[model samples]
Target: MAAVVIRDPLAFAAIYDRYVALVYSASLRVLADVHEAEDVTQDVFVRLWRRPETFIAERGRFLSWLMSVARNRSVDELRSRGRRHRREALNGDTSDDDPATLVPADTDDPVLAAQLHEAQKLVRAALVGLPADQRRALELAYFGGFTQQEISAALHEPLGTVKTRIRLGMQKLRRALENRV
Candidate 1:
């Protein structure tokens, strides 16, 4: 890992070849989007290459560490998408009004729609199960597209508290969703 981190191109390439499939499968398992999974896998490898010093072998096996990094990256991507969706909503984007903007307008795909609807419901339920502060923080950050500073200002809380809420909320939501699947 240190060799890879120290700009050893061969070592880094070897690491990529060894873990790319695992990272891709993990992302796909969690996100269920092939393109997004591929992007996440690439992003994870890029981050690994850039910050090799962060990979501490004492913490766990290399595979475990890599998986943790991949999982964290995927979660961040999901949160980012959530923020974008909220921003678009605030700007008057409505999927029902213009199906083509959200999905293929001519394709009346019930199975795809149903799967999405089910996933949405599960996420909603998981969000509702969170503690009040955690749920509120997540909603403001994710659904309102507010940065941590903005969330703190809106909620009249300290920045650290807001971050804690967001972190805890996401952990709970991830655990809940993982258990379901």
Candidate 2:
């Protein structure tokens, strides 16, 4: 699919149609602004279309790689804004109308969609199994787009303590999702 997408515009469009909701959801979760999320979504897809070969199969699954791109780009956008209060992101507060919940049911590839849905469940369950402090720290860093120092200050913890929580949380998460992701 990646090879086909690199040479065929229609194939790229099909990929976009299948995964756009997930990509947009990742951005919206971090940015917490509709317009900015939309912009980041577009940027993600465009970059994928332009550089399909960058998706190395040995690294991990395509969906994981794509979501990483979306998350990183969203975080970059958040950092570029300088001195904005990411209250919603840092606190992991999501509204009822989260774009992820609104993903269209008629995706072009049902098998891929099913796999993605399963993957999301596994990741969420693993996250839920973590201790509260570790979960909060991980959420603030990844989903909230905060630096380790920023998270320490926001949560009123020592920098080393915050680092330890994030590192241990990540090790647990990686072990839990190693086979699935």
Candidate 3:
């Protein structure tokens, strides 16, 4: 499929369909923001499509390569925004803590599938526990990639209020996950 990707866009699209979710999830987990995650996902695929020749099967599996690229790019993004984040809040500096590390492609292990299912449920429950305003702000900031000012404008709230909501929301999330983490 990759060999034909340059000549056939459909092949590239198929690859996108196969890995987009995984890539996006990894990006989101690392960046913790929807907009940056999406950008990273798009950038990863674009790099693959634009430089198919750079990939050598002899070096490694295609999927692994894609994931490595995604991880590196995401970490780079995080590093670039160092001042914006509380560095200690992240799991670790290594890719070992990456959410994508928990996912393996083309697996048939029932136990692994169950674990993934349970993790999803836990995340959903955590989201549900958040206050409505905090949750909305978190969602908008994390998933929508909106700045604090932008979020305030969109929600028609004061800038300070929006910032407070996001802060309180993050603290709540950390407290909720403190034990498990």
Which ten residues in a row are the worst by lDDT in model 1? 89-98
- Candidate topping TM-score: 2
Model 3 residue 125 lDDT score: 80
lDDT of 1 by residue, 55-170 (tens): 88888888779988887676576567765443432332122343333333223345544654576679878977999889877755543447898778766889999999989998
Candidate 3 lDDT, tens digit per residue, 1-181? 5544555788887678766877888787778767888999999988888888777889988877887788778767866776446233222222345455455533434554465466656766887899988988886665344578877877789999999999998898887766662
lDDT of 2 by residue, 85-151 (tens): 5765665655466555676544657887778778778988999999999999988888778889999
Q: What lDDT score is found at residue 77 in candidate 3?
A: 80
Residue ranges of candidate 1 with Cα displaced over 4 Å: 83-181
Model 3 clash pairs are 34-142
For every model shown, what is its TM-score relative to the native structure?
Answer: 0.46, 0.85, 0.50
Winner by TM-score between candidate 3 and candidate 2: 2
**Best candidate per lDDT, number?**
2
Residue clash pairs of candidate 2? none
Q: Where does candidate 1 clash, by residue pair?
A: none
Candidate 2: residue 169 Cα off by (Å): 1.1
Clashes of each: 0, 0, 1
